[model samples]
Target: MEIKVIAFDADDTLWVNEPYFQNTEKKFCSLLEEFLPQHALSRELLKIEIENLPLYGYGIKGYILSMIEAALKVTDNNLTNEAIEKIIGYGKELLNEPIELLDNVEEVLQALQGPYRIVVATKGDLLDQERKLKKSGLSRYFHHIEIMSEKGEDDYLKLIKHLDILPNEFMMIGNSLKSDVIPVLNIGGHAIHVPYHTTWAHEQVEAKLDHENFRHVEHLKEVLGLMPV
Candidate 1:
């Protein structure tokens, strides 16, 4: 309730992100359908992504690399040049994808800008996050931007420290519970979950969450109701 600085997660929180990746995955499966079953190839790609997270981090480049690696593995070191081109093109296309702001994202940011210092605490490749922010035209709404390598309790803690605010004075709004909600609550901060339709497997949590500092809403516009107008 004492929240002062409100931090938001980038990706699905502010825009259409995961669905693009999901669609790309579908295309990837189709491209490789000749070599393996669609279900089997999907499973293999997921495994490769999980394994490469630490090595490649998170971004279209890493994702495409994983796809390429998965392709090579599934084909037993036999991958066609055309297939490789298609896979690489997928990544390039994603990188250039237009920034589609979620409904009411700009409106909410405008409403909260004066009363609170808004921040973006998102994890992904630094350059890509920056590029999207530039394209989004929402950069003017934020006081600070924290592109993190990962989002965990420690990362959130560091963010609050940088903002010179105590844990209870901070609130995080995002679409991922595992990345944005649980960690902030664990650190004694408020978290508001605005669920997106699609989530990456690595970001899913089985347990339902309930806590004093936690809140959930069906849309980004609902955030306006939670903040002082």
Candidate 2:
């Protein structure tokens, strides 16, 4: 495969992301525990979050709204302003969370920087993603950064076109099989799935994918072995 552009997913793939969200979620669930059990509250929050995706897109800000909405729904709109403020505070904390680079992330970027056009292709709020990239200090390795609202085939097609590269000449490395791997493969590009320890329920898919241009690696550094020398 003549892969010219190598796009890496920012969250979880290059740095710690989901766990911070999960931590915030636990705080959220506990805050509303009087109205509902932790497990049920988690489900309600997840439901509201998924429902609000179309309107709010994906980000800490959306999550804060969802938490507030969930609290109101579960409490029959009896939620106090203090609780809502706390929810917003949780989101702010999440936004300020430090960027913890994953193991071998920098090393892998250093190794691939010269041979390929490296870029960040991820889905999240533009400002937040940019903040994380800036905090990560690995921004210099990337030739471009594409923070997408969605990772659908059409979205990726547009990105490939913007990069002036054919689908076959592009490759995506990410943690989500649903967003990062399947869509890229469907668009006739290469994909490598380096799964994180946890994944959002909405991003989970149940399919045994078998494709010629697909690979599953246990670690980010292993991608070096799969690259064409």
Candidate 3:
């Protein structure tokens, strides 16, 4: 395998992300508990968030709006302005959360830096993703940073073209099988799945993949061993 470029997913792959979003979700549920049970509110919020994805894309800003919409829906459009403000505040706090690098992230990047063209290929709001990358302190190790709105097969194909590499010459590493692994494999590229303790429900896939271009590792450091020597 002649892998020239190695792209890493940002959220939950390079750093702590989903848990912080989950924490904010709990807070959101509590704020609207009077209108519905915690479980009900969580379901409503997830429904609204999924619906809003096309319009708002992925990020805390979209999440804030979705939470407000959920609160309004659950409250029969009788929620107060104060409740809306609190939801916005929750999102702001989430956006301000510190970047916590995942285990062995830096060590692995340092090991592969000179040998491969390392880059970040992630999906999220452009500003938010850029800010997180700047805060991560791992940006210097990346040769390029592509903040995508989606990670579909076509999107990755474009990225591969822009990187001046064929699909077979590219490799993607991330936690999401839906976004990171399947699409890359479908495009005839290599993918490595480094499972995180928590993953967003939308990114979850139940299928067991068996592909020559795919590798699932329990830890990020194991990627070093998979590289062609």
Quote each prediction's TM-score.
Answer: 0.98, 0.98, 0.98
**Over 4 Å off, model 1:** none
Worst 10 residues of 1 by lDDT: 220-229
Worst 10 residues of 3 by lDDT: 220-229
Per-model C-alpha lDDT, please?
0.92, 0.93, 0.93
Q: Which stretches of candidate 2 lie over 4 Å from their true place?
A: none
| Model 3: residues with Cα > 4 Å off, grouped in runs | none
Candidate 3 lDDT (Cα, 0 to 1): 0.93
Candidate 3 positional error at 8, Å: 0.2
Mind giving the per-residue lDDT tens digits that candidate 3 earns over 1-229? 9999999999999999999999999999888888899998888888888999999999999999999888888999999989988999999999999999999999999998888999999999999999999898998999999999899999999999999999999999999999999999999999999999999888989989989999999999999999953
- Over 1-229, each residue of candidate 1 has an lDDT whose tens digit, in order, gives 7879999999999988999998899999999898999899999999999999999898888999999999999999899999999999999989998999999998899999999999999988888999999999999999999998888899889899999999999999999999999989999999999999999989999868879898999999998888776
Poorest lDDT segment (10 consecutive residues) of candidate 2: 220-229
Cα-based RMSD of candidate 1: 0.9
